[model samples]
Target chain A: MNFNTDFTPLTVDPDKIYDYSFSIIEEEMGEHSFTDDQWKVVRRVIHASADFELGRSVMFTPDAIEAGIQSILAGRHVIADVQMIESGSGRKRFQKHGGDLHCYIADPDVAKEAKEQNTTRAIISMQKAVRENEGGIYAIGNAPTALLELIRLIKEGVAKPDLIIGMPVGFVSAAESKAELAKLEGIPFITNVGRKGGSTVTVAALNAISILADERAKK
Target chain B: MNFNTDFTPLTVDPDKIYDYSFSIIEEEMGEHSFTDDQWKVVRRVIHASADFELGRSVMFTPDAIEAGIQSILAGRHVIADVQMIESGSGRKRFQKHGGDLHCYIADPDVAKEAKEQNTTRAIISMQKAVRENEGGIYAIGNAPTALLELIRLIKEGVAKPDLIIGMPVGFVSAAESKAELAKLEGIPFITNVGRKGGSTVTVAALNAISILADERAKK
Candidate 1:
């Protein structure tokens, strides 16, 4: 069985994580609600680690997971599937969350597969996913070129998204990559200040939104 | 009385608080010895408070003073100065610090006079000092236009300095301003990673260089 199939049981945790993450999505629509502790967790994950397994294990608290889910429900889009396999290679994996919000877990080896027949199919799938879900935030965790292509497509009117959050957590190209995302003007977006921002910060912002939503629901 | 002359004789601790708040200087060559505590004191003064009086109160240990003096003795250049002032329309003040890296405090109400007459003369005098001190670092703290002029002079082969450290530590126009300094290729330079850098980081780098020089001298 492939890693995806072998890890099928683990997907339940990630699903729960997602549900928990986006639990307060509605509250994040009005304003940002990240506390200092949440910011610290987000910062740590984004700056130091790139592996989702490691980031998932260490950074994702129950609160963080729920907050992430809330963000999606509140019209924020979150994508966290692309993984770095090498300097310039990646893979795309598809996961169904059964929600209006589109999510994909691109293969960790997609970059290597970019030269293969499956590359076109993957890109097309992503494009379709984005197009099918318009007027919502698009959160890409660590896909630079892919995110860039997505943004270009959206800008060209091939697809439309309300917001694009580039939350790639790495050195060298990370800051430059986010700067490139910020250059796209039509959609409102938020990023960590300079190199300090990472996946953790991205999730923190979402978590803050979720917390706000939960509080509102309580009221 | 001349600003320097009038202020120099005042029975005040040269290390005590004065009118200049936080100041960041990037010295390419200098040997200043500072205790860990002293370094901490300097860092805190520059990072937290924007009051010049607090800056004036900062007293470097004998080692720190000597370290700074040694940088001048060696063949290195000081490229930037970042500081805060409370009295002027511009809350921040960045100027070229001559070998005489001392603060001249004037009455808050006399800011216009200081800007029009005293500060102008000080800048001119500092520039002259840079010319006279053949082996000393010519400091250029957060003056973007002046930094551009300096770059132009260097490129034209008029002013050949050993190194330039760009240490502007504020949010306003920092990215563009640093880009100007960083654009100078083929020159050995050190700067903070990004916005997190300020006077403290710049000076920290200088202090590190100073310690290295001191170790060499002991050899």
Candidate 2:
């Protein structure tokens, strides 16, 4: 059976694929205000989504990249709002640096607490996360409720994290949760404006930070 | 510390949030040619990505939705290309119907085999999956290589899946693999054009099919 090959893929090698992807992204994403370090994180987000619109919408605090890198180098853990982020992340990179990734959404205790409180597992997970992963990097990818809860925790002085990656996707409260995150002070965060974010894109952003951290360590 | 709440989220209730999201998607998606069943899947894809352009690009074989629903009802398992799809899926819905989710990308044997073959774990995983899960649903979300391998297996008459959800996102072979899937005949499949798909969106599509299956079973 002969197959009609309309578009031939450039290459199948993983490393070369990444290099080619970055080059295309760089060419398409003409001029940007992000620093060299910040562009790496944004480029990966664009690569993951293939949506330059969302990539350009990404916002980062001045110290967010350096804060995330330092958190990784210091062996701090990551508190993921959902298991998808944990599953999609480069865990070995974190593990090699004596850091780990944690997601409390599936924990029985969190489930029970959420049920008892008449709230979401996302909120309960963040509460449990603060007590466990001090100085951790909080990554909220899918749930807007989780990002809102984290913002509340930061405001209440109940949680202190080195960095917060708040890019939750949905129609109900996603954009609002991110807007709240932008209003937060004293906590470095990487987020975007609008309702276009997900576990895959959040994983891409976190992986970018981890890659930068790893590169820094090697140097 | 007082927080500036400019935009308040509609609701924190999970069920209400889904209802709200679907309403927004229905209102924003405008006119579409998809049937009711197909629209359900496509609507969920739009909800997951928040990108109408990508959602509009989704294509389905005439029998794709019915095939996916029948497969779920028949207790056929799912072979995921990445762990994120498995993690993000509503596994409870599938499990309640006696179906299960499987991802072989992390298996030691697949990794070792990929090293020996000088290929990706995705390719090796598909090779192993075709042997194990006959009449299963093949869900490829992250790896273009896995989708291409599955297409090869199908062309060779080695793999016979009930439904194929081939939407791998990347700059390398993503668009090409999907283009290849579109060219296949006599196979029920759900896929989108271009490099705009991911584990979250794939999970959304699968969950929509499973929901329809469950609804049918209830009736």
Question: What's the lDDT for residue A15 in model 2?
Answer: 75
lDDT of 1 by residue, B71-186 (tens): 54454334333221111101121121213232222224334443555343223333443454443343333333334444566676666544454444322223344565566665
Give the number of the best model, judged by DockQ: 2
Interface RMSD of 2: 1.0
**Per-model lDDT:** 0.39, 0.89
Error of 1 at A131 (Å): 3.5
Pick the TM-score winner: 2
- All candidates: CA RMSD (Å): 25.0, 3.8
i-RMS for every candidate (Å) is 24.8, 1.0
- Cα TM-score of candidate 2: 0.95
Residue A100 in candidate 1 has what lDDT?
35
Residue-wise lDDT of candidate 2 within B77-158, one digit each (tens)?
Answer: 9889999998889467778889888999999999998888777889999999999987889989999989999999999999
What docking grade applies to model 1?
A: incorrect
